[model samples]
Target: MLHCPRKTARTLVYSGIFLATGLAQAFALDPTGDWRVADGVANIRVAECNGSMWGAVAWEKQPGGRDTHNPDVSKQNRPTLGMPILIDMRKKPGVDQWEGQVYNAKDGQFYSSTIKPLSPDQMEIQGCVLGFLCGGETWTRVAGPIPSSPANSMAKGPPKSPGAPPHTAGMTAPKTTGSVGPKTPGQKLATAAHPADPVGDICLLPDIAGFAH
Candidate 1:
């Protein structure tokens, strides 16, 4: 048997702990769930679709709002209820943040944006207009912490991290997960009178489907 020094053993232990801490910081935060926006007018539901993240309006204080400001005339008449606000957010390696485009319905423009989960219940959102950085806003969690699925249904919900946001409303990414089981009859069936599950429904929404992958 070889002799091992006590001091060397202790040093090794400390090194292991430090490495573990660093690795934890490197992985992205799971930003899934319903999150109340800074203005408190609506909640955005966020979830993972394919491989990236997407967020859309889930609830609004004043229903029947329209995306009348959309630059695309054909889309202007669309309702804002389930409209995607955070478009195509992907994880930023080595940090707990996601980078993408955020829609400003007020102006019908998309801005460069980044979302960071400050804590389990809070998130920070910052966007830029024509490369000029704008002010950031904080969002509070409201729902979700659900799961991410191929369809983003509860059946395929993603695993929740003690992180993420700007969601539970729309930036709550990863939205909330487990090994998805076989599909059930209740999964995708929908009609105008009874809509599909909003959490994962955005995955199939026409507005973003063309670009979801």
Candidate 2:
């Protein structure tokens, strides 16, 4: 059988493209886990939300800290311990990075954020203000099984540590008595619910239906 040179070249090119795409998809990183941030001062739980990923502060050193610097006067009094800071993070196609917005509780500013997994246990998080000036930190994964239910996960407050008197401005300190363990599948939901402000109209990606909490 006679073979054309052009046909052989086209077959090689197609094969290369297929392999590249396959590798990208195979190695795609999932950022759904617990991450320690702010030099271990806080722990945030990242989970699936509306086809994307959203993270909320699951634990903090100072559980009574309020959003004192928030731009909105009404929200300034809200507790920062359980606030959602990582919103609507979607994996960029054919890449190892996720793009989203990160809300800084200290300054109450939202910045363009990118998350890249350096390894299974570590991630590099970068937030930029003007697409030029940027700052970032390496976040380490928290070792534990995340709570099974949304209510169990979101409602549980951080364990208290021995420290100075609790800051008593806007919120009271979370009770330090309960065990912060993973809840069973059929665990009864708490009667008093923790408030999760809706992220409606704040998500950069409109296709996402917004987070429930």
Candidate 3:
């Protein structure tokens, strides 16, 4: 029997996985790409940032839509395109579904939500208001399965110093709703008539960069 160090053995296992799958991005929430909403009105870009999952509006067929219904008067003029629709979704332990909050721009409400991938190109998003009036829709994958970003990463940074405390969130995450998001902090939000920049990495957006754990 050949003897191998623990680290070496782990590397061998991961190498085997890469060799077998061509890539190891098949992990459940690897749904980090663009998805077309059921209504076909918009595309949401989902990605994992800071160990949690989040999504934002990447495109809107109608182009100029506002969060007019948003209770936050400050954000009422912000464009719906490129807005963060999915908030702080953390994976449920031992389950494939993720639990978090979803912003319903139509009603300007924050509803409890869960997201699960049904297939390589399909994902299910369920949203509920106050635990009732539950409803869901299947979104068709349009772009990703892409690589995660490092901006708000938890494990990709420099090694912690000896005896250093573990990384912790310096500030609480933005409120589930009534907080400006999907918009870069400090930068003036665009009007509803603004066009979407579907190609951009939303994880770099202010709300996301500041919220990651």
Candidate 4:
């Protein structure tokens, strides 16, 4: 028969408790949900994409509800809609952080970015094009499912203008699981709409570079 000391048993119990506490904290800090980021300059909403950890901005509210600066948009006199913004984010080892690219749709520029979630409902995003000239923004959690296939519709509608702003709504991501399911056409389409890029394995908006500046 094997025997264990009382002190060893106590140590094992404490270790197990510590591990559980850490896991709970991690779950609480996971920033996996719909979020809204708006400054006086712009208002944008994004949701997690299906099959990938990346979230895409599906809605953009033009600042002031009018394009007073650009004549092209002024001529149309319409709000910016359907703008794709955020890229896919992959978790980094040993930290509660995600790193990915952030493309400026208006200028077709890509920046190195990092998202460190402060809480389940808050995250600090730091983006930099030239490394030193970095800008940071904080995003607040929004009430919507994370972007996914069910949320994004494939019903072909009226022809959208070539210059139509990127989308910022219409889908949410799903929780990661090990269960494998048969793929369908809708799933294939979703994968096409938000293709995985070379920079990361996470799914993100394929056309996020075209967002209005």
Q: Best lDDT goes to which candidate?
A: 3
Residues 1-213 of candidate 3: C-alpha lDDT, one tens digit per residue:
766799788999999988767533345344566788999999887766666778998778888899999999999998887789999898888766889999999989899999998876789999998889999999987665445332333523342222111222564432111112223221132323434344365655666767754
Ranking by TM-score: 3, 1, 2, 4
Q: Flag clash pairs in model 3.
A: 84-182
Could you tell me the lDDT of residue 98 within candidate 3? 85
Error of 2 at 210 (Å): 5.6
Error of 3 at 2 (Å): 25
lDDT of 2 at 192: 23
TM-score per candidate: 0.66, 0.57, 0.67, 0.49
lDDT of 4 by residue, 41-160 (tens): 432344333322444443344422322333345323433343334566566889877777775655556678888778756778889876889989898754322223332333122322
lDDT of 2 by residue, 52-99 (tens): 556767667666878899899988987776577787777798776779
For candidate 1, what is the lDDT?
0.67
lDDT, residue 33, model 3: 66
Q: Which stretches of candidate 1 lie over 4 Å from their true place?
A: 1-28, 150-200
Query: How good is model 3 by TM-score?
Result: 0.67
Better of 1 and 2 by lDDT: 1
Q: Write down the RMSD of all candidates, one decimal each.
A: 9.2, 13.4, 10.3, 12.6
